[model samples]
Target: MSTPVPLPITWSPRRNRLVLLPLSAAMVVLFTVMAFVLPANWHLNDRVAMVVSGLLFAGVGLMLARPRVTADEEGVTVVNFVRTRRLAWAEVVRVNLRAGDPWVILDLADGTALAAVGIQPAGGRVQAIQAARTLRDLVDERAVPQDGSTTAQG
Candidate 1:
């Protein structure tokens, strides 16, 4: 029998900030221009502060919008707001998605739990559940069994 080939799967938050990020950047530019042109009875320092604050807001928007999780035959890559983690299938012990959880959690063989923030419940309960199930299945298909048998061999 021929074994089925595993395809790469990528999961990201449903509500992407692609639009928000660009919109925010435009707002920052608008604010910068307004800070210099608009007559609001404000001093130079106040205008400078407003421009800086707008830039900060745009930075925050960019941070919130850039998380993703990708998995393939070799391993999984998780890119969070501030950190990125890559783990081989053998390192993952199990996938955990429970009620009231904000995101999918990965239990690793090293006794550390990694949060898959990209697969969040905020997307929708049904969608989140389906993603968790799919990720679990992929992990199972790639992970080595306790009996020393590899899933790919089957």
Candidate 2:
């Protein structure tokens, strides 16, 4: 049997942080520098606008980097770019990360499949697989029957 995945774990995209965070910081600095270097003829409003634009870019970048999945004994919490969802163990029916899929997806009892963008293959398929398996193991271990009963029916 496969080993069980430890609980109270959090998963996020490593490659995304490595690539995006630095790029966002660099863009902010570059835009600010560019604003000051603009021709003297440019109005102060133009410089302020440029700096504001840079700040906005950084804000959006921070949001993009926020995707993450947290699992504890009670349930799973998925935080996407701008949305967060909490699902009980039984609410999840399946966990899959098929080839070419951007991220892991959880099939819920509500008949919906939710994308877990926090666990992406960009971090390497092996890592993604590990994360997927971790969640799968948790679901298998904690998920209750759809009918919410532990007893077997004769």
Off by over 4 Å in 2: 151-154
Question: What local distance difference test score does each model get?
Answer: 0.83, 0.89
Off by over 4 Å in 1: 1-6, 38-45, 146-154
**What is the C-alpha local distance difference test score of candidate 2?**
0.89
* Pairs with steric clashes in candidate 1: none
TM-score of each: 0.83, 0.90
**Per-residue C-alpha lDDT of model 1 across residues 103-142, encoded as one tens digit per residue:** 9999998899999898988877898898888888777777
Candidate 2, residues 39-75, lDDT tens digits: the string is 9999999999998899899888888899999999789
Best by TM-score: 2
User: Candidate 2: how large is its RMSD?
Assistant: 2.9
